[model samples]
Target: MDFFDKAGVMAIGSRLRMLSEQLTEEATKIYDLYDVGLKPKWFPVFYLLSHDESKSITQIATEIGHSHPSVSKIVKEMIKEGILSEHKDKIDGRKNNIRLTPKGKEIAIQIEDQYLDVRNAVEEILNQSTYNMWNALQEFEFLLEQKPLLKRVKALKKNREAQHVQIIPYAPKYKTHFKELNEAWITQHFKMEDTDHKSLDHPEDYILDKGGEILVALYNETPVGVCALIKMDHPEYDFELAKMAVAPEAKGKGIGWILGQATLEKAKSLGAKTVYLESNTVLKPAIHLYHKLGFEKVVGYPTPYERCNIQMAKTL
Candidate 1:
């Protein structure tokens, strides 16, 4: 007859809150049974101060994952109850440090056995569950630290927008766009080399005249990315995929992937037997994109650029 019995996953937040209240009530009963004049909520701050007497309010809040206002309220109550004391920090005169009072220390020593019993009872209750809640919580916290929930959501939004972009062949108007985009990216990461200058300054002479092709990506009628496939002079019909760049604001929307795909298709259309690329190890996302496009690493590929430590090629 519990409301949560039918709510299922939709009421997960409520269910967790109800469980927390139930556990707190049980803990309160245990404290009353042992005649310990302490509140269940106050235990976390008190316990931290007991171990580290010189913790500031900010430090306690951070360690316990509680807000400053909430920790401040708990500290105020503890100070009123003579369970905690505060003093100005010697190293930082502006900061106030917290420590357990003499009376609080005495109470902590007296209730050590009771606290152990409480811990054992909680462990026993958790062992009856299908999964370890403590381990799961630790993992959840680690994942949040690695990539926050809001950041993941924003990235998903960017990916959706990126899917709607259109890939188009290079035009006269897009010539400035090609140089600006490539310069913005290159200058942000590394200095532009002579090879970059020659290709970017005159795409027609350096790329088009040499039997190469340039492709541009458009999002909302704005140029967001550009990539070039440069043909080699050898009779083997080899092409180098180079000068790929995406705008900072338009990145992470699959623009790079789209440009890479278009460049590969252009290479194939031009009768290229193999498509090669030179890149640095620092460009992890770019390297991953190349790998996704079936480009495997090769040794001793002659590159005109100084930053070209990684070389990869895909057979057309």
Candidate 2:
């Protein structure tokens, strides 16, 4: 590949000067045909208004990255030429809004055809491939005006950190910790015959095939709660949510709500339209939390599992 020398770069720049002069000459001819003088800078403002009917001058200036005063001056001239009009802001008494007048709309509509003509003329003169590359460069310049990638990453991290209770992607290693927490909850809150049902616990780790996950809540390194999603066999049912138990030590911290939200988000991500959950009548607080998160009563599907006591479904 041949590198562009300093003189070659200047030569290209000098050619662009001649090209811009030719474009302006051709543009003036078209304006005479349309009976209006259209400035190049006005094209952006016209296109913006055409796309979205109403916007404030401040919004326009911010979007196009021009000084508000400069935008105001150009808008004023366009208004005087009967190309645009101003209106008082209804929502806010302090601000003024701008929109294209009928004449402005007509000219803006013509700009589409005029721009095509200008593009074709340049393409014909500069060869088709060179024109395509030059057009791509212009687009790249426009994209450069957007917020940088680093700023977007910083914002995402900030949003993630502020969450009240996090539902991180589940790991298999927390099964024993979760079992311990459930056993403690049963012993402390409700008197059960046996809190040691190994078969009833941790079925997710040994589940069949796809779409199974567990969310465990932690309070200073101690696992406080566990929730699991079991992929359903029937297409109509999508997935079943089960084993939602919080530690007795970690009760009343709204961890259940967080678990519910996490479970729903997971179900949605897996393309599940409906999520069914089962709860025991003894856990009235859990039922209430389910209701708050938009669950509805449904006929309980017969299941041998001890955790599938009462049934509810949340449609995504």
Candidate 3:
């Protein structure tokens, strides 16, 4: 309690673990009272085998959402207690199949009454509460599965650092940095196509002079990212958000996002209503960021760059 008082909400993990252990201890005691001779931990394997399911350790672990070593330990304990036994699997000689022993089957039948009693008791407990603990746990688990705590913390840290970053209009001084950042990412992940060279080599003539705009992200006065709002000469789109890249040293600092957003705003200021982009699927983070910027994938758009396999567009 003192540790929790000091730790506050950060003690959530420890709190959950403590609750799990407390529940498991209660379940163990209940099983002992029933004299079913079944361990609480063995219930998963026991219940499956009770239903006449002969499964390998892997299969049992998978169905029960546990690791193989965990299931193996329970199986071993049950075997020693003469409640379970195993024989070579018919289809797989390398694997052993586990099933309830005659002793185990008798115990399974005896435990049915206890199972019903426990379920009813738990349901009564739930009825007394405002929220269903089972549903709450599943929802919490799904949230974690969608985005783990680690990623959440990392994103927070990155967001804080990005707050110090300033998105600025590209100048002649940042012309070299603009090319280098884009080159670094492109060459590392893909071969630089001719179109890439034409733009990176001469952004002024290739991008800027064509009524397009370039933007740079300055983090503590250092150029770390660049993006271009290329004025599309086509009728379908007004601007192409292209040549976006963040320096490797500045990765996870959110510079790319800021730079891209700035370029989009710049395009909007220039009377552009729709923006387009092309990318390869292998660049998953880039693709995700594009989607985050409200860009939806579109097909039937031709490209001069051979590396372009996917096209996206957004209406401002």
Give Cα-based local distance difference scores for all models.
0.88, 0.72, 0.89
Estimate the overall C-alpha local distance difference test score of candidate 1.
Answer: 0.88
Superior by lDDT: candidate 1 or candidate 2? 1
What is the lDDT ranking, best to worst? 3, 1, 2
lDDT of 1 by residue, 147-201 (tens): 9877987889877897679999899899999999989978877899998899999
- Candidate achieving the largest lDDT: 3
TM per candidate? 0.58, 0.43, 0.72
For candidate 2, write residues 158-202 as lDDT tens digits. 455325455565565776866666666666655443323632363
Model 3 lDDT tens row, 21-105: 9989999899888987977788888998889658899889999899999999999999999999999988879999999888988
Score residue 30 of candidate 2 by CA lDDT: 76
Off by over 4 Å in 1: 1-38, 41-155, 235-237
Q: List RMSD in Å for every model shown.
A: 7.3, 13.9, 4.5
Off by over 4 Å in 2: 1-164, 186-205, 208-210, 305-309
Error of 2 at 10 (Å): 72
Candidate 1 global TM-score = 0.58
